[model samples]
Target: MTGDTVEAVSCTQLAYAFGETRAVDGLDLSVREGEVFGLLGPNGAGKTTAIRCITTLLPVPSGMVRVFGHDTARDRMAVRRLLGYVPQQLSADSGLTGRENVALFARVFDVARRERAARVAQALAAVGLTDAADRLAGTYSGGMVRRLELAQALVSAPRLLILDEPTIGLDPIARTGVWEHINAVRAATGMTVLVTTHYMDEADQYCDRVALMARGRIHSLGTPAELRQGLGERRRAAGTGATDTLPTLEDVFRDVAGSGLDDQSGDFRDVRSTRRTAKRVG
Candidate 1:
């Protein structure tokens, strides 16, 4: 593909397994450059696993995973340099000041020593953390903390930003604040975003397009309105209720995943990790 047409992220029949269990299975996905793409799913739907593979944190044990046309497997460092990732778990150090946290990421991402300070400052400003940049992260509010993490991700000026439950434990106001910063940065830089969240409302409101995953595969993919309208049409045709109001994205999620979520739910370790992150962030 040409530079202008290269996909930000592409997974062709991607799959990953943990011994006896498969986390992601034959998943095909494409994220266009400069769009906010949401990967929506229940806890065990393999969104994180797929994200790990794309981020080059996990081996591409099966099919292809590419980031900006760079094969994740063959060009690990190149892919790493092109992307910034904020995982579900908190990455900020409570003892470190906000500026320090962002600076640390800049160093890790190999930002030039001369440029690191300026990049950190710019990242902090982008996330509205300029005032709090000197404060220890532990003293910041939950919302501020999330923004700090966003700043850490932004410090590298990556082409693609991958966020796994970035606003998972924040209050509504905090969530909105985080998203505003995210959008602002995207608008300014034309960065591609690949986010995974259980909050369907966030996906419906913020994402350009979404894919609903379940049982190790995507069950639906479209713009929020398109998926909701499709389900609404099927409901009307099947003589289900509610023709007066179009179905919400949550309704579409239920129609897609539903009770089978329990069957595919992540194991004990997943539960523990998720709760730990939520508790810390909350």
Candidate 2:
């Protein structure tokens, strides 16, 4: 895609701070249309902060952020209409049934009442939850809750979807199921997706391109293959002791981010470590 058609999302020198902590610092990124872009980072690395800015949940303090060429700050409503966001935390109302929750969002988005039913049904079916549509969200498993969130995000037929660690707190099977639905939605609608995840395998398998971030900065940005190739080249040049095998994205992450993968709390932290490592070795 040309830059014009491809520039679904763009951030230039984006920065955010909370008191003394610099949550996001001088970050730059671009996501193209009809592609899955993964923001891979560790916990406290500013992935969510960046998402919040792009979604217009948090105000832009220093940099420019545009969604579909509209300034996030000045054109907040226009941007909101074009984008759907599924936050890291479960958004489903435990007291409401799955269908009820989605219908609520549809109403909030001002979807026509006559069309709400079909829209909710379509979203539920898309996520393979039509059978449990009437079940309370609290009774659903972590994975089911996630799927419901995805359904809610899709109810408005947004052109751009921002998912913050969508698969967190799920078993491997459920994680795979979430990915399946995400890919299906992308394939069917050609919607641009920007996902934040600490799952290396998820990024490797699903994202067309990934940006590795650390300490509120982008360390590297490239396609999964390109990242692996770049790491391989560096390893080859580093000579025999670098590593015997081709380095995965995890290795590239470590080399670029200068950190090791340690078991950490929070799904964001887990995915971040999957992307960050101590060093790149041969």
Which numbered prediction scores highest in TM-score against the true structure?
Answer: 1
* lDDT, candidate 1, 135-225, per-residue tens: 9998988778888999999899999999998987678988998899998888889999999987889999999999999867898999999
lDDT of model 2 at residue 42?
69
Q: Which candidate has the highest lDDT of all?
A: 1
Q: Give candidate 2 misplaced runs (Cα > 4 Å).
A: 1-3, 240-242, 260-282
lDDT of each: 0.90, 0.86
lDDT of 2 by residue, 202-258 (tens): 899999999999889898899999998888887788774356777888777667655
Clash count, one per candidate: 0, 11
